[model samples]
Target chain A: MNSLLVSLRVALATMLVCVGGYTAVILGVGVLTPDSAQGSLITRPDGTIIGSRLIAQKFDKPHYFWPRPSAPDYNASGAAGSNKSPTSADLTDRAKQTVERYGATQDKPLPADLAAASGGGLDPHITAHAALYQADRVAPARGVAREAIVALIERHTFSPGGPLTPDRLVNVLELNLALDRDFDPTSSSK
Target chain B: MTAMVFILLIVGGSALLSWPLGRYMKWAMDPDETAGPGRQKLDRIFASIAGTLGTEQQGWKRYMVALLIFNIVMFTVSFAFMALQQHLPLNPDEMKAVEGSLIFNTVASFTSNTNLQHYSGEASMSYLTQLCSLMWLQFVSAATGVAALAAMARGLAGRKMMGNFFVDVQRATFLVLLPISFVVATLFLFGGMPMTLQGSAHAATLEGLQQIIARGPVAAFVAIKQLGTNGGGFFGPNCTQPFENPTFWTNAVCMVAIILIPMASVWMFGRIIGRVRHAGVVFAVMLVFLLAKISGAVWFEQAPTQAFASLPIEQATGNLEGKELRFGAATVPLWAVLTTSTSNGSVGAMHDSLNPMTGLMPMIGMWLNATFGGVGVGMINMFIYIILAVFIAGMMVGRTPEYLNRRVEAREIKFAAVTLLAHAFFILVPTAVFAVTPWGAATLNNVGPHGFSEMLYEFSSAAANNGSGFEGLGDNTVPWNIATGIVMLLARFIPIILPLAIAGSLAAKKPTAQSAGTLGVEDVTFAAMLIATILVVGALTFFPAAALGPIVEHLKFMV
Candidate 1:
């Protein structure tokens, strides 16, 4: 009984210090962070919230760079992968369709990210190869020069270090937002 | 191919880092010794924390009671937070309360350091609950395991007075877990994983689609989640979600972090008991098993099964269906072995998607449970094996059983038996019960052998307190949540309680001088016997289950 009481007392005290005090410090530090602390909210000129830089948004329009296809649709409330077996007919059909839609030639097969769905249905970025492949289509549709679009993609391209240090990734949302700003300047604020 | 190189780098780096860190861990846990002036100052600081808590020297029973009560308190507080998360401040997502059964499971899971997340983190929890409740327990539960090991080690050294639990917890948290986590968290934050209190990041896709990106203070959680070997993720997809893992450097770091402490604890045991060579024998045994499992997993993962030959994609790039392209082939399987070997169950690739033979590696790793197991508990589990081996070897050689000169008698053997048998009982009995039940059958996403593997894997994971799963099982229902909750509680506490009690019993006895008839654990012959015993015991208990599940699944695919 004495030990239990001591145990309880010590536990309660530790909880107060570690859970209460330590958490408060972490929260304080979190608030001080530039973007993510506030949800990484991107805003328009009128201060209306647009979206977050971390999450992926739907970019179905031909004028924009497409994010990787999400499985079971991009429902944030219900995050899931398609969980398709490699041999599943559904997965194969979808991949084939995606490859054809992207106009893959004999010389260049569709990048895995382009033809396949990401584990998280809401992957925010696409492979540089996928981005480059779609640049030709996006430039002609948006009435922008192909070279200018490729350059824009290059600016937004991120190489996430390590062995993939040379392999670039383009955030579909960031590149799209930049497209809206460069091509249609008046609507950049809104 | 690059993944193989990265895996080598991480393994080599951790092995190099473990020597100094192991020495530091021994110094920190030992009350008598201080490294130098710098450590003396830190020791004084820790002493005050113990003073504030009124913690003094405790015997084994008193130490166990204190640890249990603290865990109980933590469990209750964490449950309350999950239940009332909606009303809590910092809930920008306005997430509602978790259901009653799930709250029990979640709290029990975290308290045991199992971290079997039934609910997706972002969808279910608020930032406050994640940080204060879940993350807090991650630190404490890890500290609890370390403390248990220290107390038990003191007993193994035949010390009458075990160290203070309060002092152990404080040092483990403030000194070890905190400093390491800070460096890793800083690395993650700089490396692109987002740190935010915001509910979710909303963005527009290039295809003019609106996407709500799930964002949280992931970097901080990810660091402790790996470093502490508490494998819960802030997202449902766990580390596979790009936001949680982000880049290759973070992924490599996370894998290294998973095995780092468990590896060190082996050497720490050596330092504590003043038996460095004995620790090396044990470390070599663990490394052999770990490397064997990793190699097997990698080989199976790289070769596409005949069943998958029908898929064009599998033919082109091996089995890339359930794996992230960023992690590559070798790292995915390496993560499987690393996570299971250390009881750090965070996965970068889908375990459920691996070939059946590859899937068996992790299950067997967990079954063995002593191959560099969880934090401090892993070493204790290894000690249990040591005791058992000593007893068995004594019988074989026709002499009295002794370990470190302490007599191994019936009571010690019984305790060790209970600890080993408890894992099989909790795992097998529940699996059988679930296999017959309609609820358990309903949760399976695959049928036949694969379905059986999924159910078996759930109970195995729970019993081992290694929380990675088959992922296809719909385990959010009342039965899974409650049953696994109970299994986790019993498996975690029973092993801990029994081992400490045995250690206490052993500690009370006077050490006898080693006779010519005595068996030393440091002998290569003894090490071989120990390895054979582990393999035979594991194979006998689990081979049937494996045959029914992954082994048979592998056979069917082969034919």
Candidate 2:
């Protein structure tokens, strides 16, 4: 009984130190890290808070650049992949759908990222190659030159190869948001 | 190639850093240190707790009892919180309470330091449960392993009594895990990882679709989870999830944290036994095994899948089917190897998507379970192998089987054999049971060898207390929950108990001077022999299972 009591006391004390004291200190530091510390929320020009800079958002319209396809229907509350194996029929169907949707041909290949859901199922970025491939479609819808759209893709393109992150990828959400903020077709036309 | 260098640097850096970390651990493990006048007040409180617990000086059995009581107390509290999560505070999402069997499995998994998560963290567990129960157990359970290792070290040194359990647990928590976790948590928080009590945020997607983004006190859980080798994730996608591992630096920090203490504990073992050379030999064996796993994973994962060979893009770019583009082929394989090597099961990429050979590497590591394994228990496992090796080598060469001047007798060998055999028994038996049963067959997400590998991996993970999954097993059912719960319990305690029993038996013997006929454990030849013993033991036990699952799968993939 004494041992159990002492164990309880120690457990409570350790919890106080770790959960209360330690977390309070670290959380204070987290809150100080700008918007990123709290889900990386970005604000639109209308003062409304949007999603994070990191998490992918749905961009299905022709004018907007699309992020990678999400499983669980882009529900952040339940972030998970299809977890389908290479030999899985569902995986094959999904890949086929993605290819047909993207209009890939023999000469012009779709980036693998476009055909596959990432492990997280919430990847914000797609390959630079994938991003550029959509330029023709996005350019016409936005009433922009192909050259300007390619430039925008280039600006948003991040090399995946890194001492940190290594690949040539573009953040789809940030690029689309930039397309709205910096390159308004209405103002350019006017 | 740069990814390989980065991984090598992290491993090399952590190994070098373990030297100083081991010194501090040495101080913490020493029971003879006086609190002194400057620390009288704090020391008195600790001393009182020790007194209350009757933890002054205990034989191994008494010590085990104390440890069990402590663990049971923690387990009970966590189980209660999980069972009553709906009524708990910090549950902003109004998540319901977990059912009985799942609660049982979850608590067992965490308490065993296995953390084989059957449920998604974000959608299932409330913030209160995540913090108070899940994160809380990760610390104590890991500290328990470190405490147990310290006790075993005491027995190895031939101490008449193993040190007080309360003191060992307290010191391991306060002196070792607490400080390191504090710094790591702070780094995560400041590095843009979320640490909020607010529920999921309502946000608009680029498509103007409304979505609720889940948020919680992730930074704190993420820190201890990795550092403790408690690989449970705060979110379903695990470390690969951006919120848990935001930047490249955080990913590196987490990767290094998993093996930090386990590697350090090896050095501490050599320090405790007063034989750096012996520890060096053991460390080398672990490294070779770890490197072999990494090479195999990287080699296979970088090749295009045989199923996808006809695709020109896949042939040109290698297998990107289930990998994060940011991590690419290079870091993903390294992460798989390191995570499994330490039994830190947090995944940065989908293991289910891996090629057959790539997926087998982590399984092989788990089967060995001592290639720089979990925080402290890993080195203890290696020590058990060393004991077995000594006994075998002595018998072969017509010498007296001795390690650290203690004779390797029948009782010691019995305990060691039980420990080794129990791992295989728990893994292979349960896997077989599941393979034949409709209940187990129902859980498989794939057919044939892939499905066989998934089941084998599940039991291997549970037995090894390595929690990463193939993610293809539909294992959230009641039978899986309860069955794995029981497996986790038996597999964890049996290995721990038998090893400690052997340590106790060894501690009671008087040290004899090394003679010409004594087996030299630190010799290079003995190191080679020990490596062979570990491999041969693993192969004899698990090779058939491996051949049935990964090897056959690989062969089929070739055609």
Task: Give the best candidate by DockQ.
Answer: 2
Judged by TM-score, which candidate is best? 2
Worst 10-residue stretch by lDDT in candidate 2 chain A? A181-190
Candidate 2 residue pairs in clash (backbone atoms < 3 Å): A159-A167, A160-A165, A160-A166, A160-A167, A160-A168, A161-A166, A161-A167
Please give, for residues B1-559, the per-residue lDDT of candidate 1 as tens digits. 5556666777778877888889889888774544777776766665564554454778999889878887887798788888888888989888888899999999999999999889999788998889878988888899899899989989888897888887788778877887787778777766567776666655443344565667777777888899887899888878888778766777878888999999998888888888889998999899889889988988887665333343233244455556655554567788989898887788787677677788899998889888999999998888888888888888998887998889999999999998999999998889989999987898987777878888898898999899988887899999999999999999889989999999899999999997777788887988997888888776579888888988887777644
Candidate 1, superposed: residue stretches over 4 Å from native: A20-33, A36-54, A62-65, A84-110, A129-159, A163-170, A174-190, B33-55, B204-208, B304-314
Error at B447, model 1, angstroms: 2.8
What's candidate 2's i-RMS value? 2.1
Taken over the whole model, the C-alpha lDDT of each candidate is: 0.78, 0.82
User: Could you give the interface RMSD of each candidate, to one decimal?
Assistant: 3.8, 2.1
Assign candidate 1 its CAPRI class: acceptable
Off by over 4 Å in 2: A160-166, A185-190, B31-45, B305-307, B310-313
Which predicted model would earn the best lDDT?
A: 2
